[model samples]
Target: MGKKEILVVDDQPGIRMLLTEIFTSQGYRVTTAETGQEALDSLYAGSFDLLMLHYKLPVVDGVQVLEQLEKDQFTIPAIVMSGLSEDIMKESQQFEIVKEVLAKPFNVEEVCEFTRSILE
Candidate 1:
């Protein structure tokens, strides 16, 4: 079987590059998008086993992107990452499809392990 594919969506180029490098080194297929719209476009073009999304995004916010994905019936698991406060986390957790939320400055290994656990 092929390696699992992960889509990393973040407005920051540094974050995107970091995730791309981390996942690639771990033998997973990694794709990236700098904005929510770009991420959505990438999703429409191909299949991905998971998504790592930054909460605050350009063009469309991460929550909006998640809503759209739900509307479109794309059930891929997602991990939402943000530096937001507890209230935001509570609100985002209302979405059933969202598996987890990781705060910013999180350990890269934790993120990778979470992804692996869910995808496996």
Candidate 2:
């Protein structure tokens, strides 16, 4: 099989760069966007094995993106990342495609392992 693909959305350049480097090292094909609109555009232009996003995104929040994905009938699996409290994180669990909600300040190893598990 070809390398699994991932669309990672985060507004911070440093975080985006970090994730790109990490996922690339893990042998995954990764694309990134700084805004939910850009993510949606990318989604329209291509398909990915998974979607990883931050809850507090610019233009459109993560929840809105999930709503849009649902409306468009895209059921790809997703991982939501945020520094918000667990109670707040629980909100994103409502989406069927969102398989994980990772709290921020998470270990890179954990993230890598989680992605590997999902892509497998």
Candidate 3:
């Protein structure tokens, strides 16, 4: 089988770089996108095993991206990260496709572990 591919979408370059390094170091094929539309475009162009998305993405929010993906029948797993409160996370959980909700200021190891757990 080929290397697992992961898409990391965030508006911040620093965050995208950090995630790219983390996933690439773990032997995963990594792709970075700065906006939700870019993420969707990337998704349409290639296959990915998972998506790591920032909740407050520009052009389209994480939920919107997930919705679009579902509408298009793409079933890849997703991890949504946000600095929002627990209440907001709970609200977002109404979306069935979200595999996990990660709070901001999270540990890098935790993110890697979650991604590994889901993909592996």
Report the lDDT tens digits of candidate 2 across residue range 8-115: 999988888899999998888999999999999999899999998888899998889999998899988888889884964678767888888888877899888888
Return the TM-score for each candidate structure. Answer: 0.95, 0.95, 0.94
Over 1-120, each residue of candidate 3 has an lDDT whose tens digit, in order, gives 999999999999999999999999999999999999999999999999999989899988787898898888888998998888385478667766678888887799999899989998
Inter-residue clash pairs, candidate 3: none
| Candidate 1 lDDT over residue span 29-63, tens digit each | 99999999999999999999999999899899999
- Name the lDDT of candidate 2: 0.88
Clashing pairs in 1: none
- The regions of model 1 sitting more than 4 angstroms off are none
Residue-pair clashes per candidate, as listed?
0, 0, 0
C-alpha local distance difference test of each model: 0.90, 0.88, 0.88
Once fitted onto the true fold, the runs of candidate 3 whose alpha carbons sit more than 4 angstroms away are none
Better candidate by lDDT, 1 or 3? 1
* Winner on TM-score (2 vs 3): 2
